[model samples]
Structures are given as C-alpha cells and as structure tokens.
Target: MATDSASACIRQTERFGAHNYQPLPVVIASGQGAWVLDVEGRRYLDCLAAYSALNFGHRHPALVAAAHAQLDRLTLTSRAFHNDRLGEFMERLATLAGTQMVLPMNTGAEAVESAIKVARTWGYRVKGVPTDRARIIVAANNFHGRTTTIVGFSSDPGARDGFGPFTPGFDTVLYGDAEALAAAITPETVAVLIEPIQGEAGVILPPEGYLAQVRRLTAEHGVLFIADEIQSGLGRTGATFECDNAGVRPDLYLLGKALGGGIVPVSAVVGESSVLGVLRPGEHGSTFGGNPLAAAVGIAVVDLLETGEYQSRARELGAVLGRRLEELVGAGVQSVRVRGMWAGVDIDPDLATGHRVCELLAERGVLAKETHGSTIRLAPPLVITAEEIDWAIDQLREVLAELS
Candidate 1:
C-alpha cells in the first residue's frame, strides 16, 4: 500500500506474466469517477478509461450497488437452467438497441465471434449460400478482437503474425471505400464486419456517408452488416451507438466494453429476430455469458444511458476537447481526429513519439495511451467535468511544449 510498492508490483508482473502488453509505469490501486489513485495515492485523470470500458467512470455508484446486490442474491445459473435476471437483461438490452433479440456473452471478442457465427449460419440457412463457402468481408486496419478467428482477418501484422495458420473464409477490403466493398462482395459473402470508428487504428474516422453506403450496399447485396460498436458505442461517441450518428442501422450490433459499467465483463450481440434466430439451442453458448451478476451490472448500464445525459455530456465536452486539441495542430502536434469524447492525436515525430508524449502527460497527472506508433488516443469518461477536460488538455499542451 505504500507508494514505492508500485515498483515491486511492476517487477513481479514482469517476472511472472506474459510480455504481451507494455503498459504505462503507473500502478492504479483505486478509481472513482474518471480518476484513479496509485499505490502512492497519486491521483491521475483517467483519459483512456480502460479503452472506453470505464465510460461510466471507475466503479460507478449505481453499478457498484447493482453488483453488490447481485452478490447477495443469485450469481450464476448456467444455461442448463434459467436465472431470473437473464430475461429482463436481454429484454431491456434488446429494447435499448431497437432489436428483437439479444445473445449475451462475456467479452467483446465473444460478442464478435457470436455475430460471425450468426451471420454465417444465416447465410447458409436463410440466404442459400453454399455450405462452407461463406466469406465475411472485413475492413483494412480493423480491430475487432484478439481471438484466433478475429485476429486471422486483422490487417495489422502485429496482431496476425505467428498467430496463424489462421481462420479462413474472410476477405479484406479497403476501409471507407464503398466501391471496394461492393467489388469484394461475392455471392458467397455472408457479412461485412467493420468498426464505425476504428478505435485501435488511432480512432480513425471513415469518410462521411461511408456507413450509410455500407448499409445500402449490404442490403442490396443481401449481406449482413455487422458494426463493431464495442469501443465507439455507449456514449463514448456522443451517441448510444455510432451507427446512430451516421443514420444507419447495421443488421447486427457487436456491443461490449461499456456494457458492464466497469463492474464485470459483459457483452451481447443484438439483432433482429430474423437474423439472430438462425441459431438452434445448442449451436453456441458461454458459461458466464448471462450470469445474474453480469446481467445486473448491464441493466444498470442501460438505465444510465436511458436518461440521455451521458450522450449529451460527451457531445458538449467533446466540443471543448476538439477545440483544445485543434489549437495544438501547429505546435508540436501533427494532426488530430476527434469524435465525441474520443480523440487520436498525432504527435510531431520530429519532437516525440506518442509513447513519449503519454509518458510526459502521465508524469503531469494525466494518463493516456499510444496507438499505431506516433498517435495517442484520448477517451475520457463521460462523467469527466469541463474543468477536468481543460486540465488534461493543459497537461498535453505542456507535454508538447516540453518536447518541442
């Protein structure tokens, strides 16, 4: 519990754990409402927010209460039997998404995998696609999840290398190019899976109308449009869903990250009955997918979003974030792409790498993350205040100034 304990903890982790992730040096011990305390009790603004998993901020009171309440009651009843909480959770989630059915899962990757399975099954059973020939078209630089099948289609070599012999039946297309997508769709194509905003690819935003074009093309071609909203949904992008911003409705929604309110790992594939109804009872399932605890936490999350306050907060504070980041364009910052409360800031390589900038910012009590080399991603919790946003920006400015 001492401040110096962080170094010991880091050393222990490095010694025992896999070296898959290179995290920032700071060791977070506790968090509450957009801020985290280190073992030393140093508080830092949580700009990354667990890659938007903590969109409601760390350990939100409502979510915590729900988790606590569930702990005292039923927790897990596997799919073999029924749990009272699962039906309500699914119904509420389906209603929130305007979908007729919900398939709950434990992680974002599982949700994505479920969507893929549903799409492929629908293709074979409903679309009359020949068996074992169904192909799913994925966008270039898309980051869906890290499972073998998910990473098999990844354009990023870091994610794909040595992970193969990978899953087949996937075709890669240039992202944001409707013409390319159309050309790639063959008679055997089952679905087009993409992220509305490519969160891991430096929060990349597609060209305007790209999503709408995808919807039109998928509808016309009789292919399912799967939107990976794990990172961009749940008020992170100033909307309940990023597809809403583009005025498009994907056939299936792959939702996770924020759905659990940072209390547990919860995800779901929400879609119309016509699409999701393809699965027979024993086709697929998870042990902890819709446990009472996860459902309870997820219900709390849906309740919070029902008020529309979080989305509005993201929109209003996002403007402030945009203005402050835009001002840095010519000052040791190369460029910035901002949508809602999310931003990807490209650092001037002549001055510093995104990792260096993040390190400097962390030293100044603002924690962020770097992606794709020189680009740093900023996604503060919606609960973050205007003053906190300004403060984080000030730290970034200072980091840039010092680097310059």
Candidate 2:
C-alpha cells in the first residue's frame, strides 16, 4: 500500500523505529499461498517468502490447522513443566536431519548461540580442550545473526560497525577457502562453523568440493564441524541440506527459518547425542525453546518436508529460474547466483539501482528484497506452481526490459 495510511505507517517507523533497514514503501496486511495482499488490496507474488520461512507458502492450511489445534491445548511449558509435543518434534527433526539429538530454541540467532555454547562445552567435557580457550572459526561474508558473538566474526562493516568492543574467541577467514579454515584452526579451536550457502552475502556458494574437503579436514583435526543452515536448510536447497549436495556431514547443525512453518519462530541445534548433550541441568535454556505450540508447528514442518514432491518442486523450479536468470547476463544483468529455489540477481548498477528496481517490482505485483548492494534475492515458496513461477519470472523480465 502506498496510500495515506501506508505513508503514515512508514513515517511512524521512520520516526520511532531503529533505522537499521531501508524497506520499500509498500505496506502488506495479508497473504495466501505465494501472494501477499498489501493494504491497498494489491496482490503481489511474494518472491522473498520471508527469507524462506514461508517455504510452505504463506498460510498453508495444514500448518495453520496445526497451530490452531496446538493453541487449544497448550502453548508454553517453559521446561519447568514438560510439553506434550516437544519429544515428537525433536524426534521428527532429528530423523529428518539424520542426527541423534535436537536442542530447541526460538530464533535462528538463538540456535546459533546454542551451537556455539555446545561446541565450547563439548570441547571441554569431551574433546579435552582447555576451559575458556575453546574457539570457533567462521567465514567472511557470513550472516549468522545480529547477536554480539555472531557479529564478532562478520566481515560486513555495516553489520559490525559501532557494535564493539566485540567478543573474543571467534576467528575469521575467506568464505570458500578450505585451506584457510585449516590454517586458522589452532589447538584451541573447537569448531569450524559454516553456512552451506552464504545467503546474506549475496548467495555466495562455496567452491565445489570445498565442503567435502572441510568435512575431511575437520575430522582429521579433531575439531567439530558446525553448520548454520538457518537460511538454506529444510529443502530450500532442493536437497534436505545444501551440504548434502557435496555428500558432506557436519557434527552439528543449527536450523531455523522454515522450521516454524511461518506460524511461529522455532529453531534447533541438531547433533550427535554426545555433542548436544553437553548442556547440563540449568547450564542453558530458553523460555520458548521447547514450548508446546512451537513443538506442534515444528513437527508439522518436518512432516511437510518429508514428502518427496516438496523437494522435487524446489529442484525443478530452481533450474528453470536459474536458466532464466543466467540469460539476463546478455540483458544488462551483472551476475546471477542460484541454489534451489533461491536466486540472487545482480542488476547492472549503471542502468538502475537494486532499490529502484525493487520499488518498481513492488508496484508491478512482485516482492523481492535487496541484499548487499546491487543484488535482489528471489526465493518464492516451493509450493508455487510452474505456472505461477513463470508468471513471476515474466513480470521480472518485463520490468528489467522496461528499465532499459
């Protein structure tokens, strides 16, 4: 919506809100399937899908049903009392992840924090690393979250600027360099954390064979390999994991984004029993971590991903989107990156800006978000039909052509 109320709301945000993000002017009020209805009653195809959390598409009936049923029974038990749905959620999630233990949390960042804690504790209790010396290594161009410790290793200046004095114990290296990771790990290093595909860094994928090499090297070094799959996991990448494409497995997985089925915020650290078991009684926890409402929705999400059709939908559509975007190289596009149903299109800066293009896209009934600079990321719901995807792509093509 770009009406009086919409401008008023935007002005309110500008006045009272932290100016962290420069969002477009459109104001949305409702969504169904892959389409969001702005306050002005304009229906836009949601290409960002809330950064993949709406992978099941906005307001899937089955997931909404699950949320409703859970709300009628119980919502939060807070670990002081056990929730009925937590165990089932953990079991389904662990099975889907091929792991033995699942430690639940509420946000992707909190899940990441939990993974760091688990790694350090596992180093001390199991791997015999010295106390308080355990270190975790991350990559450049990484966006784990905005937590103080997570931002400590961030390579992006805007993310980390003025946020210091930062936390110690995190080392940084290049994104796709396995050798850099090997060299950076000291004896004090307990975990080498990575994203299978760096989403926030313009959808940067690692060099082929890099993941497998890291998997092997981490094993050889007696260091745990931790994966932050918040933005890339749960079939967003066609496979259950983007790491699976390289036939690699990490010791620990930090999962979020799509796990709550877009109904709630739920995340988890799934790992081997010994690794996740490091958290002792009262050592760490969250108020909404294993709450019953989230657990129910999470179980439903796992069930949704288990279907073969869902993964195949992402794979088949991702290829179509990739080919169309690659053709943009001849159509004034600077570059294109595609993995699963996700794509990062780098528009030519000389012609028009990413922000301007996005504003125009919003006007023409498509919604994508800009990342880094000069790049707009497109990740529609996997539930989208081939026809819907083609329609969205045609809209993008028309818009880009008009910009010429």
Candidate 3:
C-alpha cells in the first residue's frame, strides 16, 4: 500500500517540483539512528546522511529535545533584537572551534559567502590590499556552494556553465598542489580558501604534507587561510575539524552542515576578532541567520561534540572501513579513499557508473551517492555500528560482483 503511495507522491513531485535534482527512486518518509524508512515501509541504511547534515543521525535524542524545548518557548528573533539562545550558541561554537568570534548564518552557502565578504573586507582594512583588487585563491574542483558568486570561480563546468557574469577577485589553482597554490598567491591575494578534504570531488585528500605547507605559505605571505569545513568538519573526519588531522589551523573556519544537528539550518563563520571584527554593525547581516531554534539546535550539537565520543567512534570504525574497502581494490573497486568513517569508492567504470552502483546499493538497502563519474561516497552517521558498517560493505561487494 505504501509503495503505491510512493509512486503517487513521486508523480506529484515530478509534476510540481522543479527538475533540479534527479534523486534516486526512494521516497524516504522517516529516519532514526543510521537508517531511514521509505514511504514503502522498507528500511535503508543511510550512508550519505544528508551530506553530513545528519552526522548525528535523524532525530538524535539530544538535538530533537533541544529543538522541541526551544520550539515551545521561542523560535525566531532576528538579529535586530538579541535572542536568549544566540549569545550562548555563538560563545560555545566559537570556543569549540577555538575562535574568538562567530557570525551566525542559516546555510553552508551563506557561511561561505559571509566568509568571502569578511576576507575581502579584512584585506582592504587590515591587509591593506588595493580597493576591489583583493583576490582569493581557490582550488580547481572545489564545490563551495551553488550561489552565483561561489560558482563563478568553480572549475566544474556543470556548476559554472550557464551561470555567467560571475564575480571576479577569485583565482583557481590546481588542488593538492602546494607549488601551484604558492605560485598563484600575489600581493593582492587576501585569502586562500580550501576544503581540508574535497567532499564534492570524491573526498579527495591532499598530499601528506600539503595542508601544513599551505599553512606555512599562507602565513609567510601574510594572507588569511580560510578552511571551508562545512562538509569535512564536526567529527566527520574523526576530529572536530579536518584541519586537525593535518595539524594545521586556518585563520577563518567556515562551518555548517552538522552544526545544525539535522534539526535546523545553522551555519557560522568563526575566526579571531582581528579578522571577523572587520565587519561593522550594518556591514553584513542575515534576517533568518540566527534564529532561536537554530541556536538551540547548534548549542546541542556542540554539547554532543564536547563529549568526544562521536569522534572516537569515527576513528574506530574508520579503521574497519579502510580495511574492508582496501580488500575490494582490483576486484570491483578501482581505488578507495577512506578517512575516518567517510569513504569514496571508485567502481570499475567498465562494470557500471557511480549512479548505477548507488541504485544497486539502494536496492540492497544501502543508500549512497555518486560523485564525478565512477566514484560513490559513503558517509553514514557516526552512530552506525560495526555490524551495520560490515552490512553496508557486504551489500556493495555483492552489487559490484553482480555487475562485474
């Protein structure tokens, strides 16, 4: 009965919804822990976790409780007036990231956009870059967000083409190449914005010493190092921030995704007062950026991370994941990249595309997504058990064997 209902729902969405995303044929109705139940009443292990927004998993007890408690009291109080929850949220989040200030926003793109504004402003005021000549160095295959200004600097044609009239002041350099990045920097460069791990580029890790080199170069050049940790932060990479794994810290940390605790859209730009303090009262603002509900959820998320249990779990399971995935190389997987509990499995292109592999995995009760062409990313909730991890890997093994 529910499966029939799912077809109707899909048809209705196709009729009314914008054809922006081509989602897999599964109508998820509800989720808990690391699993989601579709409208058809079938369960699927959630491997993507809404791209890490659900890092704590859907309906996490603490986060949901925070949302519910805040809902009963207060929800929205724009930046015009001080909300009770905003101060605590900002303080806690800033402290968690080891920053002195926080600029609350509602989405990942907004956080990135805000960071860009701050960097550009800091350049003119603090770094003394020529007016409107401030340049930000970005990687080649970066996926910051879909905003026009963000996509303007994108190397991926899929995200850049047809979105013309892009904003300037950004230079693209080859990713994971310290030499290229160092060569790209100029006197006008204000910041070097990069992801510690390129999530959208199939969890691409930098060369062993690339991040430390970037840190040194940025500091020596007197340019701000902005780490966009939206997808790679919040215990996703076995640490509070992926930068920790590299033993480097960016001047500005652009954070989101798990910050909202899968309950609300909460994002923030955290940095020292010297950099983030450049913003004046009316310089930058967002109406729905720091609502009470979002603050409550974010505060709860910080509290959860403060325990360090989730980070430990990611490290423990990540080892199991790495061992299992490494075994699959040359069998059906061309290559595998595992960091913490996150993985990017490159399926043999001759056997199937990443999309086809995801479809087969979905049929087998595992949910993942394709990146590039033949790479599929697996980022399940940190709460996932060893048994569940093994199960998902087994499903992938079966899918690849069948296709081969």
Candidate 4:
C-alpha cells in the first residue's frame, strides 16, 4: 500500500498525465547504485534498472560529473554547425561497437526508425533493389519501440491495435527459426532486424546457434543483419554486445538505453560506411541527436565500458542470480531463462500472475516488472552486488511461498 505522500504524487500524475502506462504505485524520489528511495522514504532494490537504461546504476559519479562539466560549457548546436564533442563521441562509440560509422539519435525507437531508412536507402543505392519495394524481415514478438513503423512490424496486437495503417514492406518470421527466416528472404529483402535477446518479450533467448544462423542466412541472401541491441547491449549482457557472446557480428548495431549512462537519452545506429554512408544530408537527422551534453556523457559511458569492470561484474553476479532463480522453478516459477545478468522467470499461472508477484515483491522492498502477463524480468544494474542479488531473490522466494 502507498503512504499518503506517495499516494498523492501518484494520484496527481494519473489525474493529469496520459494513462499509457500502469506503473506500480511507488513513487521514487532519488537513487544511487542499485537502490532507490521512494516518496515515503522506503528503499527498494531496483531489479529492472529502468529496463536496463540504468545499467550503470543511478547518478554514477563519472557520468554525473561529465554532465555537470558539459552543462557549464556547451549543450546543443542543433546539428546546423558541427559541435566539438560530436566527432569524438562518434569516433569512440564506433570504435567500441567495432563499426565504421555512427548515426546518433535520442531514443531507441529513433535508432530503429533511422536504421530502417538506412537499410531501405542502401537497398536502393547500393544493393540495387528496385525503389520503394525494399522489404525488411523482422522476428515475431519483437519490441523495437512504440513508433508506428516499429509497431507495424511487431507481432504484439496490443502495440499494433488502432495504431495503423502501418508502414508496409516488412516480412515477419518466427524468431529462432532459421528455416522460416531463410524462407522469408527474397531479392527484395534488404535487412533482417532482430533483438539479440528479446528483452520486452520476457527476456527470451534465442535457440543456441540461432544468432550465427541468422548471420549466415542474411549473408547468403545479401541482406543486412541489424541487431537491435538497445536493451541487450552495453554491460548488461556481460559482454559489450550479446552478439559478441555468440561470436556473430551483425551488419548494423542499434544501440541505446545505457549508452547515455542513465544521464540523457542517447541512441545510435552503428554500421560500416558502405551501409550508413548511403544516407545523404537532410535525408534523416535529429536536432538534439549529437548535442554536446549527450556527447560528453556518451564519452564517459564509453570510458566505463572500456574498463570491462561492469561486464565482469555482470558475468560473475549473474551466475549467482541464475542459480537462485532456478531453485524456485518447482516452487512457483514454471520456468526461467538467464543470460548474463538478465533473466525472465515465468511464474506458474495457476499460482498468480506476474503483475501480482511484482506487487508482492514491491511490498517487500524489491522492484520488478512483468511482461506477457506471466513472466517477470530481472535486469538489475550491473553495479548490483552479489549480496543484493541474494536478498532480492530471497524476497521473490518468500513471495512465491506465500502465494503457494
């Protein structure tokens, strides 16, 4: 239950704001590391990490300092005149992603939209696909973003309902099925866009060797394999990219979420010059895309990943998280899937819904969210310690026992 202070804030916001999201009743005031303070002064372990946007945890010192220093100097130049920070930020980010070019944007959805345009344009300019007929293949149940174009390609009805007439020329295929993907490809297919690990679809991991097969199939068909790493990239997956773990490189890397170090909204489509170079000036751009403030924070974020400290933490602590979660499979969890520090635990539907489990976890001072009605995802910040992971899992265990 929410206290008067928290209830007032929730009520005021719901009364005025749009009802697009049904967030838990707790109102957070401040955060540091893996913990947050609610309006009523209660503390909770943040298991969702703002859906992996807070991978570095909240207000990281280096990121905050970088933001402050940038604030004292320059902010935005609207991409009209080149900003000093843009080039360096792009260069470093490209180097980190192992790509030749970076097209900066402000959100994951924009990055997806931008990549779609790039792939389509490349098909026309380089691949010699007939104009306006280029098609991109996407996996079912994918959640790239809420953009109309992105939603149009999504298999989820809730996201697509009443949103379209959606943009056309997208082919849908079953995820983790190489045969379906191969069958979907044609001369008009320009790119294969997929999340390396499906985050919003209950943190689903593809079948073993599935990513490599996608790479192989796309290469044989001369289609660009665009990995939407917006949620699975950075240090959250215990590797710079989830693709890296599979030893398969995609043609384009769509990055966001943690790229801003939880400071600002930063996203980009990273690819070789052959692909991204197809975009001419004024064709696609964002005014606030490569602003100085975002660049400074992005540079700091790259600096952090360069050290590989967070990735190591995620790998080491993720093992601990996976083991604890597996113990509950027979208790109330029907199944569990884990990769690095990310997990999706499917609560037994007969026991309770994922939403109810999350509400109980919140009451016990742990924060988590559900997806697809019955699965709860755990993606605590990479900064979270082993002890904190134990405590959070303990809370879930108790909650399951109570439900049982």
**Which 10-residue window of candidate 1 scores lowest in summed lDDT?**
1-10
Tens digits of per-residue lDDT for model 2, 1-404: 47997888889989999988888888889999898887778788999999989989999998999999999998888998887799999999999988899999999999999888899998999998988999998888899999988887898898898898888999998988988898998888899999989998888888989999889989998999998889899888898888787798899988998999999999999989978888899999998899999999998988888886777888999998898788778586889989989888999888688887888888788899888668889999998877877788787788789999
Clash count per candidate: 0, 1, 0, 0
What's the lDDT for all of these models? Answer: 0.94, 0.88, 0.94, 0.95
Count clashing residue pairs in model 2.
1
lDDT per residue for candidate 3 within 1-404, as digits (tens), equals 22678888889999999998988989999999999999878999999999999999989999999999999999987889999999999999988988899999989999999999999999999999989999999999999999999999999999999989999999999999999999999999999999999999999998899999999999999999999999999999899999999998899999999999988899999999999999999999999998999999999999999999999999999999899999899989999999998899999999999999999999999999999999999999999999999999999999989998
TM-scores vs. true structure, each candidate: 0.99, 0.98, 0.99, 0.99
**Of models 2 and 4, which has the larger TM-score?**
4
Q: Model 2: residues >4 Å from true position, as ranges?
A: none
Error of 4 at 238 (Å): 1.0
The root-mean-square deviation over C-alpha atoms between each candidate and the true structure, in angstroms, is 1.2, 1.2, 1.1, 0.6
Arranged by lDDT, best first: 4, 1, 3, 2
Best-performing candidate as measured by lDDT: 4
lDDT of 4 by residue, 210-232 (tens): 99999999999899999999999
Model 4: worst 10 consecutive residues (lDDT sum): 33-42
Given candidate 4, what's the lDDT at residue 75?
Answer: 96
Q: List the residue pairs that clash in candidate 1.
A: none
Name the runs in model 3 displaced over 4 angstroms: none
Candidate 1: tens digits of C-alpha lDDT, residues 1-404: 22458989999999999999999899989999999999888989999999999999998999999999999999999888899899999999999998899999999999999998999999999999999989999999999999999999999999999988988999999999999999999999999999999999999999999999999999999999999999999999999999999999999999999999988999999999999999999999999999999999999999999999999999999999999999999998889999999999999888988898888898899999999889999999999999999999999998888877
